[model samples]
Target: MMRRLLTLPLIGCLGACSLTPALQRPPAPVPASFPVASAVPASAPASAVPASALGWRAMFGDPRLQRLIDLALENNRDLRLATLNVQAARARSNIEGAASLPTVGLDATHSRERTLATDATSRELDRQTGVNVALSAFELDLFGRVRTLSEAAFARYLASEQGRDAAQIALVGAVADAYFTQRLADEQLRLSERTLTDWRQSLELARLLKQAEQNSSLDVAQAEGQVALAEADVEGRRRALAEADNALQLLVGSELPGDLPPAVSLERQPVIARLPAGLPADLLLTRPDLRQAEQMLVAANADVGAARAAFFPQISLTASFGYASASLGSLFDPAREVWRFAPQISQPLFQGGRLRAELRLAEVRKSEAVAQYERAIQVAFREVADALAGTATFDRQIEAQRRAVSATQRSLELSELRYRAGLDGRLDLLDAQRQLYASRQALLDLRRAEIANRVALYKALGGGLHADSDDAAAAPTESRG
Candidate 1:
């Protein structure tokens, strides 16, 4: 009677599982056009970026930089953590997939029992043994509950994979930024030391002239002050160089090579590549963070389906086959054999409104995910616009800084000659020297900013370090060709 009662609901649940509602994707709010002007110059042509290409090796031409990126990818702790996250997500997805299938197991048992006679017919001792192979406590996913859960898990796994790619891109950008900063610091340090040496020589000459009564004591004092200022600048630059070196080492996840190649000259201007003016919407499909957001939204949608499915009845099946006897030798006898099969179903008829509340909660989470997806799109658009604007402005700034540096250099030479000829005061020469140094530093800074902006642009366009199905399709053709 009890078995029949359990079986009724199981049949009903199986019937309900067949009727599934259509799953819907939350609507995305995409603008018709980017809000900012698309005025990138035609001088820079759009470079073709392959989806499967990753690492700084191909993007950055420098072999040393490629080595650094490789080291970072291997040893960086954050990247390792991201890798572990992907593994965890994959394992979770596997676990979820297993829930959709029936489970079967084999069992074997032997037992003995002894008891005092409690009644006239009671036995004094008992022994039993059994062996069985059957399905047990397997829940049938009649309402698509397991399927929905598995889908959510799969999306989460994809998100984890994208998260790893995001980390890799960020790591590459950081290494490049640090490398440029280090080079700039080295340049400043060299300039300071050279200036300091010149100041020392000038000071010695001033002292000699003063002793010969050819110049005043004030001239000697002024020369000493110049030497002190140059020395101070040298010390400051040295500290900056050390800091930059440490930062680069940290990014590479190791100490700088003992024979680390000489620092690249910051003065060498990199040719900025022109990217495509109007990118296709599909370009963003490869952006790791955007892909991650989309996956999360997909998972949330699946959760809603799973939660809704929970409102229906749940069904389970259990079966067992075994033998038992008072003596171990009789356990395998035909008369001792026994079998049982039980099917069960449960309905949440009343739970203080808990089921309704859970369904509402799932809906709320799904809504939140939709909002996040939209926000991610907005952020991505803004990043691209800002990078484009920066790239445009940086070109003008670089040209202007170059001109300023050249003019300052000429002014410094003229001022020094005037001072030696007594046509200009020592203060004038000092001012010109300060102006020249400032202009040179500013030019270095501008160049670094320009390169950094290019990096940002690449990141914004989702050009760096990505993998997708398109890449897979292209691989075979390329190999064959």
Candidate 2:
């Protein structure tokens, strides 16, 4: 009877596995094409290469930078935690998947009881013992209820994996950005030191001219103030560099090693890749956050099926077959064998509208997932567009800034010559010096912006093509400037 009862649900599971609704990906809500204003030096035609396809090694030409990124990947606590989360999600999915099979376990029971002699009656004792391999209340997935739940768990597992990928992408960008920032600060500090020396020389010259009645004390005071300001600027840049190092250290989960080389200055950082910003918005399909959202949506859809299945009957089976004996010597006797089987069916009649509400809640959750997925796509599109526009603008701005720096430099040299020959006052020389310094600073800032924008574009493009989950560790690297 137990074998017959268990067979019915198993057969039902085989046939009704398709009862859960089929999964269909929703259409993307973005435009058919990306609004790429201009590709970064897009001389080459748009290649179908994804940013994820472009490995980090290719993007960062500096060996030191590559090492730092590798360290972050290994030691960053957040990234490690994300990997652990993926493992946990896998475990949850396995648990759900196991629900479809019966839970077979060994169970043993023994009891001994005595009745004390009462009113001249002799004392008597009774003993009972049994051992069985039992199958507990195993649900029969006739309507795909447990199966739907299991499917949901698997989808969640996939989402978690994508989420970890998203975290990885963000971490890589952050490390690269901090590395660039530190290099810029180093260059800025050098500039400030050079300016301070020039200002000190000018102050001495002003004092000498005043002693000869050719310059006033005010000129010396102004020159001294300029020197003081330059010194302060150097300290400020020092603080910035220190903070950048701190940020990088935190990302690496330790202090940067002494043997690692520093990154090149802003103007010296290599352009390793010519990113194809002209890819269609559909390239967002490569974005991990968007993929994660879609998986969550898929999981929510499965939940709806599970909730819907709740209104119907649930069938479960419990069965045990083993030996029972009154005497220890006869424990395994065939004549003392015992067996039992039970099959239960539960159908909800009423529960204060609980079943209906659960179904509605699952449906609402599905809707929420849909909105989240759409929003992720929109945000990604916006970032790509901003990076594209910024890349073009920075090129022009940097070119113009270079010209301004050159012109200011010439003006400073001529002003110093004129002041020494008594053709101009110290104020004119001082003003020229300040102008040149400011222009050079502006040029450095523009160069920094240009480099930072390129990194942003790479990140916006989904961080290049990566190997599929199966062989991601062994994927070949590819990219070039």
Candidate 3:
């Protein structure tokens, strides 16, 4: 009996040998290189410091923006929830891992029984007490089902970590985008306020000229109309500023302090450093969403192995070691010692084709994961290419807009001068003023677009996150417009 007990270890060794299929990584369905603009500076080598290494501070030139980014990372509800999901997944993986090992439990019991008197026997009673350590329904993993499931769960835990990284990257990008918008709103408010002041001065001049009989009531009415339009613009800008402030507060996860520092004008906003348009395969692998998808594939592959194992026979073991006696005082007596050991195997000869269906389901899930993984890669590739193409076009647009603003400025001056000399009408002066205003606003919008494009590119390139070793979200990409 002792010898047979010793053989249990050898039985375990045989039982644990895996029958699962060999694992292979799915091929990435992506282009060999990124579609980028010719103007992209190729001076930066592929091995240059990744944006993930540069902290958010290094990416943002403005101190105020840096503070906001830092605060958001610490307090954003979405980021906090993502981190919690990682913890939950890890806990679930741990629970799955325990299934591979036998569950040992301690048990103690006492019993009393009485026999009724019979024709040939007197009444009798019996009492017994016992204590034992028991192992229950432990699957021997003969075909690696338990181990395969554990491994799959572990992969899902890892995937959750990558999901967190993706969330952090998104949070960083969102805060930056919102901050840029608020700055744009502030600049517009200033522009409108200044324009309103100038319009008021022009209105006053018209009134004075009309009083002196140098201008007619028509001039006063036109000047008054321009002043009213400028006032409306100022009011509209004030509303925009308020809305922008509310948006910033929402992203920050708390109310902003009144003393928060002012931002630089849109034109003076610092640019984020550009990543190399080209990257090595390893660098491309840094995207968290891609890695998450890959992990899902890994988990699915392991599920297939577990499903296959289900088609084979299962081995289970149950055992107990204990002491028992007719009386409580003798429970520990040497002769009272007892033990049991049982090993069983069951083959699924008939289960209404349930095993077959499960196996097919696992295969289907694995195929779906493969397609999802590939799709993530494709999306990542397109985002990077779009950002690259947009950057070059934005530069041209900004230049053209600046030139247009300048031309309108010159036109406004000429219109005012010709009107004063009575060579042009009031309508021409008003039209020139309107053109200059529109051009300046357009120029500001273009600048904001260029800045936003940089943020988008940073996200597309996987936010410089490296999930293999680092746990925290990698530092932000350097800010460059």
TM agreement with the true structure for every prediction = 0.85, 0.90, 0.88
> Model 1: per-residue lDDT, tens digit, 246-347?
998898887767665444575553434455435435434646787787788778878888888888888889988777666777778999888889999998
Clashing pairs in 3: 59-479, 271-479, 271-480, 271-481, 272-479, 272-480, 272-481, 273-479, 273-480
Per-candidate Cα lDDT values, in order, are 0.74, 0.80, 0.80
Per-residue lDDT for 1-481 in model 2, tens only? 9999998878876646554566665666777766746445554223345566667766777778888988888899999999999999999999999999999999888989987767657887889888888999998877888988998999999899889988998898888888887777878888988989888987888899889988788888888888888888989989988998899899988878889976566776764436666555554456778778888988998999999888888989999889998787888999988888999999999899999999999989988888887788778878888887886677767878889999999999999899889899878988999999989988887777777887788888777334232243465431100
- What pairs collide in candidate 1? 17-142, 127-326
**What are the RMSDs of all candidates, in order?**
4.9, 4.2, 4.8
- Model 1 CA deviation exceeding 4 Å by range: 1-46, 50-55, 114-125, 269-272, 322-336, 466-481
For model 3, residues 55-165, the per-residue Cα lDDT tens digits are 555456677887787778778999899999999999999999999989999999999999876764787788889999999989888678999899999989989988998
lDDT of 1 at 17: 61
Candidate 2's C-alpha runs over 4 A off are 1-24, 39-49, 117-120, 281-284, 464-481
Pairwise TM-score winner, candidates 1 and 3: 3
lDDT at position 318, candidate 2: 93
Error of 3 at 290 (Å): 0.7
What's model 1's TM-score?
0.85
